[model samples]
Target: MNKKILGLVVSPGEAEKKVNTLIDMIPCALKEVSQNTEEWQVQTIVDSLTGSAESINEIFQKINAHTKKNAWDVTIGITDLPIFHEGKVVNADINEKNDVILISLPSLGWKLKKNVIKQLIIKMALTISESDNDSNNKRSPSFINIFPRNYKSVRLKIKETDSFHTRFILGSKIKGYMRILTGMTFINNPLNMLQTLSGVLAIGFTTGAFCMAFTTMWQLSYLFNGWRLLLASVSSILGMLAWITVSHNLWEVPSKKNRKKFRKLYNLTTLSTLMSSILIFYFILFLLFLLLSVTLLPPSFLGQTLGIKEGIGFTRYLDMHGLLLL
Candidate 1:
């Protein structure tokens, strides 16, 4: 029988782009690995994330139904949504009977994302093609290496028969925390702060530019030691982060259905995202403050305010203290 594969992408942007690109490569790679004589065909379906899939089993059922309706032997689903199995963030799900692969894009995280996903797809394709079995024999060594050495790809029997459904997840909680943190941060996208925080940046730069002309500001910047400046920067960033989180109501309030640990992860991801964005904001503001201070602050005035003689001492003081204060 001719084997047909369907690539279903459930999210826009990176998920759609990467999965579509990888779809073109699947046929060729499958032929090389499985070496089947039957004609190989791949079809792609682009769809928005399904909000109805509240559980992994629900997602599996949806993918399975789609695959069966399309008459595809195998369907590979890539989604940006976070999927959980047995209280852990499920990175990938494979149903042996349905021949469907569901991947949680965020669970893969941002680091080495494309490579990790590509490897997972190829490995799963090979597995479903019957390259290996439920025994200890004939294993793909490279597949095990995709996750960290400490990580385990646990397989559980979904039926009374010999077939097994496998899930790739971070077994260790610490590693899981790091993985979810980076993944959620990637999804939140720190770079978008450039556009979203335009008003905040404008007001801050405007006020700072005006402050640069004042001798009090100059003297304060000069008086502030390294530790004091560092403390100010930290406090400023934290304050901004706190304000944004509270004002926008971004904090995830746990519900009765929410898992305790997962809820913590959710809140942590939010905090991490906010912290990254605020740091970026602070960095840009620091550059603006530095430019205004150096260009507008005069050597004579700054030297007198700083109580340092003109020339090298004044220049050194000004340059060293150019660091932004709170």
Candidate 2:
């Protein structure tokens, strides 16, 4: 299939003025071509954004003339713009295949940038794609359903099948949290803080479980010397604690201001979590290494040792318990 070219028609003037000109022209153009008029039979106006009927006619004439020379046909259609009937506006939906324009013609009160027109055409055509899929009624594998699905285009269709559950799970929980913290109670089934808490717990539990497994492995490898495994266990516990503290702080922030505050705080929180975990782990490791050195080294080395072996053992026992039970 050929890739689509989205185009915009800016009407050769300042963007704001052109947009305003289009907005003013729409209702006026509709007025001239009402059911009482001879052009009433026309179901839609293909090109019209400016508030001028003549300009619209001229555009059609130009298209007709072009078709005669190039032997190429271009179909066009127009629809009502409900939101920006008259306003300073930015059409975020405008893109290469979605064109938007401003016009002054009475008949063609508004125009789309050529690309906006193309997207509208494509979106209309996709209705048939849905019907085709409905006829087949095929179901994808479970793995394919793991990611998000938006039936807008072929690109999205492919991506939906390719992405992993990790993304979906993360996104779903985030969206759920947004709904909950915002007090968006209008939703019949809003995501609650409880669910967000559950997701965080699940993540912490998984981390803790992995740490326990690693500790077990270290216990096997070093035999009597489990300082390395103890270190990992302590780090994991600290990481979980930091994660929880930050997440709780985030959850407490009111949603109205959270959007603005989050960008800065989120980075800090993430960095703090990493640094805190690393520092805690290494600090423990240093203490453990010193205590072990006291036993392994000569009597002169005992003065250099900072931690007692009893303290290291007690801390490891506590870290391991906290991690596994978390």
TM-score of each: 0.81, 0.19
Residues 1-326, model 1: lDDT tens digits = 45655456456766776766676776777776666644456677776556432455656666666777788766777776676665666777777766678777777666536666667777766666553234453323355556655555777885422457677777776676577678878877887766889898888788767666666766676667767777767787788888998999988787866666667777888898878888788777767766666676656666766687743344444434444335
Highest lDDT: give the candidate number: 1
TM-score: model 1 vs. ground truth: 0.81
For model 2, what is the alpha-carbon lDDT of residue 268? 42
